[model samples]
Target: MSAADVWPIVKARLELLDDARKPLIETYIAEIEHRMKHYCNIRALPDNLLYVWASMTVDAVRVDLPNADEIADTVGGGANIKVGDTSVSGGSSGSGVTNTSKAVIDQVVLDYRVDLNRYRQMRWGG
Candidate 1:
């Protein structure tokens, strides 16, 4: 399905009230489609996988949202506090380690492995 077909569902899933983020969501959907093409060896995603596609897109948006960095700094075991010239920093629960080489699609693939596997095309011969 084209981004136009999937945009409304994604917007609803995200509870978005306006089109301000439409372009960003569409970008994520396109990236997911590209990665799905490579990962599943399919020219296009099957219609049955629309929900999966939208869900993955939503996840991609959430992971890369503008405020994600701010949230990461204070949540999930990463925190810093300063009081009266004294400062203390808490150790991160490994969430601070970022692998820049990994694309957001990689995580989405892991997240939806079960669904994708159901439709994965097997490749054979060199």
Candidate 2:
């Protein structure tokens, strides 16, 4: 299957009903596929790895397009509260944010290392 075939599955996993973010999602899908190809040394993605690719794409999208504002709105916090001489501040747990030094794409690949290994093509040089 091609990357296009995985788009719908990624959308479904992300609960996306509209196509507003289609382009963005597609971009992530391409990058994920590229990394997978490089890591596994495979020319094309096998059908068995479709769901794995979709999952990695979903994770990258979630990290890059985190719904922080929506989450904060729903979980209300007081970041500007002050009481006399004392001051108090609070904010959303920021659980949606992933604190990682690695890029989202790299992290996705690393996260799916085992799955990708199954399809890896070994190479040897003289």
C-alpha local distance difference test of each model: 0.64, 0.69
Give a tens-digit lDDT track for model 1, residues 10-96: 878666777887776687888888777778888888898898888888666555552443323332243543222223343433332
Worst 10 residues of 2 by lDDT: 81-90
Off by over 4 Å in 2: 68-102
Candidate 2 local distance difference test against the native:
0.69
Clashing pairs for model 2 are none
Summarize candidate 2's per-residue lDDT along 7-29 as a digit string, tens digits: 99987766666777788779889
After the best TM-score superposition of candidate 2, give how far the Cα of residue 16 lies from its true spot, in angstroms.
1.0
lDDT of 1 at 32: 83
| TM-score of each prediction | 0.69, 0.72
Per-candidate clashes, comma-separated: 0, 0
How does candidate 2 fare on TM-score? 0.72
Candidate 1: clashing pairs of residues? none
Off by over 4 Å in 1: 66-102
